[model samples]
Target: MTEHVLYGGKGGVGKTTMAAATGLASAKRGERTLVVSTDPAHSLSDSFELALDGEPSAVRENLFAVEIDPESRADRYQSIVSAIASDLRAVGISLSEDEVERLFGSGIPAGGDEAAALDVLAEYVDSGDWGRIVFDTAPTGHTLRLLELPDVLDAALETTDSVRGQLHRMATSTRSMLMGPAAYFGREGGEDELAELKARMERAREVLRDPERTAFRAVLIPERMAIAETERLVERLHEVEMPVETLVVNKVLEDVDEGCSRCRTRRDQHRKRLAEIHETFPAFEIVTVPDETGEVHGVESLERIAERLEL
Candidate 1:
């Protein structure tokens, strides 16, 4: 079975770094790993020092990376919706071109990006290609929405299918009465398409909630606001039954010079916040990553972070 690891938290909390490092670590352990950036604002390529696209590309031996473009995914999702509308029209449902345009003219619906990301994620999970897959998710709010979307979308799809069936039956009855005899235009293709999407969403939800196969790691800085946000995130995760077991406290001031009072004071504040983090999430295994000398980019830096991650 393939294992999944997702790193998520507030924006600029080094989630991409943690995810990249974890991928490197997994690959070093001889597992074929793919690091995926599901964030709309992708920084995985910058972190890896290589250009990436929707398709997975080789990063190093046993390691591959990809960045899911939200815009492209959203466009694809819109196309799928348009296909369903076309199918309805083919089945004798009265949908004017103007009405269809009105319904889908808007670029992307609310949560469309997340829904598309979920679809892409399900495809990757079903592929059974990588030994392990690590995800660098979006910020806390967007990541939470992504995790919650499967259920919301499933319900919406169910409702849509039911309504479509009812409308089809009504259309068939009316046409038969008017024309004396009318052939049934069954929409098996559209139904199958919807069914497949529902199944994919359900599978993704299962993978997310399964602890043995999936791990949700929250990454944050040693700050009060970040800690509070993480606490809320963990609570929501627990509510959704996708509990987080690991917390990464990144960019902690590790070694303050004795002579520098300013550095020492900042380190002291970090310690206080660290203690609070432990108190708040006592069950979580917290990993502290010290502030590096410079920007954390490139494979070499990621390797160092991987060591700190102890993956």
Candidate 2:
């Protein structure tokens, strides 16, 4: 079974940096690792200082990376819908070309960006090409929605039961002449495709909730707003029974000069927040990454931070 590590938090809290580092660490341990960005902004490539596209590209001996492009994913989703439309047309459903195109262009069933990103994630996990996969996710709200999407999808599929009934009525209306009987129940029709999609979505949901197969790492800075947001997120996840195994307190200030009053004040504030963090997340294993002097772009700097991940 493949192991998945997902790094998620509020935006600008170093999630991409931590994800890249963790992937690098896993690769160094001889695991074939792929670090993927689900954020529409796509910063994983910049973190490695390497060019990447929709598909995974080798970044090191055992590391690969991809920046999932939303446009590309939308196009792929459209194609799938188009195929479904064709199947419907063969069964004599009077759907115009524009109708099919309109359906394709509409947003994905549940929370467009997160749903599409999770679909891609499910594909990667099913492929089994990597021993470990690290996801650099979107901001907290979007990532949480992605985690909660399985329930939404289950409900959506249930709503589609009416559509399936309509399709069956259409089949009987046409006497099933052009469309084979096998098309009514199997892969030749839309029903089986929707069922397969649901199965894949459920599989991804299981992988995310399984502690042994997956780890959700929440990253945050030592600041009031970040801490508050993280606390809320942890509570929400707890309500859903989704486990967060680690809390990464990123960009923590270390060794501030007492002569510099500004640095000392900021350090003191960080200490208070840090104490609150320890109290708030007593069950979580906390990891801290000190604020670096320079920008942490490129593989060497990322690897340095990855060393601190202790994975």
Candidate 3:
């Protein structure tokens, strides 16, 4: 059984750290794990202290990582559209050059970084190649948009298909007039490709919505802006019935440099904000990662953070 864990929060928060930590923890438990960064501004490669590409690379025992390049994935997406056009051409009436350009223009019709990332994600989820997949998602807004992508894509595809159906009728009639009754025109593989694409989308939707297989972990710091963003994110997730069961309160000032007045003030502020978090999201299981002396990166630091999570 494949289990997916996604960490999402406001930008500049510790989502990448938490995601890396969680991936380490899951791998420590002997699960084959892959930590993938879906953020267009990816930091997973830095976190792992290993150069990574769009393809997964081994980071440690049982652990792998990938930082998706949205542009590269968008190119792959465009290729799929082009392939579909080729498949259409195989049977009979080929689309006009303008039609081909329109279909493949700008990649997905309702496309953006999030859509590109989700297309990569959908591929991974459909593959079922890893036991555990941990996602370091984009900021709150982009992550939410990615989660909502399937519905948007479904609607867009439906509209496109309807238009194509009408065009198909028109094109077939034209071919009949030109080639007579025994014309060699058919939909050929176009419908099959469309069905395959739809199936892939539906499969991605199932994997994301399955609570038993998918979990969302929100990472935030004890700051006003982070708290506000997280609250809004939770509300949006509730609206969509996407499950977010945990809150990781990262960068909590614990055992800070006592002599520093700034540290002291921030620590005090953290405590109060933490109280608000407890009050605001009472249902969430709260976990804490205390502020480290230096930046947390690389496998060792991520492992330490994972230990702090006490998972």
Best by TM-score: 1
List the candidate 3 regions with Cα displacement exceeding 4 Å. Answer: 79-104, 184-189, 257-261
Q: Candidate 3 has which clashing residue pairs, if any? A: none
Give per-model TM-scores: 0.92, 0.88, 0.88
Candidate that beats the other on TM-score, 1 or 3, i.e. the better one: 1
lDDT by residue for model 3 over 1-311, one digit each (tens)?
A: 33988899998888999989989988999999999898878888788888899889998899999887766755545655665565565446488878977767755545467666666667877687888898999888888988888788788767757756665666567667888875544544355555556666767677788889888888999998889989999889877778888899998887777899998998899999999999999989999888877778888888889887644
**Residue 151 alpha-carbon offset, candidate 2, angstroms:** 1.5
For residues 1-311, write the lDDT of model 2, one tens digit per residue.
23998898999999999999999999999999999898988888889999999899999999999987666656434544655565577466668877865765543443777777777778988998989999999998888898988878878766665566565666555655556574355434455666677787788888888888888889999998999999898887776667686999999998888899999998888889999999988988899999888768998898778888965
TM-score of structure candidate 2: 0.88
lDDT to native, each model: 0.85, 0.82, 0.80
True lDDT of residue 193, candidate 2 = 61
Better of 1 and 2 by TM-score: 1
Instruction: For residues 114-211, write the lDDT of model 1, one tens digit per residue.
Output: 77678777888899898999999999989999999988988888887786677667656765777655435443345666678789999999999988
* lDDT score at residue 289, model 2, on the 0-100 scale: 95
Best candidate according to lDDT: 1
lDDT of candidate 3 vs native?
0.80
What clash count goes with each model? 0, 0, 0
Q: In model 2, what lDDT does residue 25 have?
A: 91
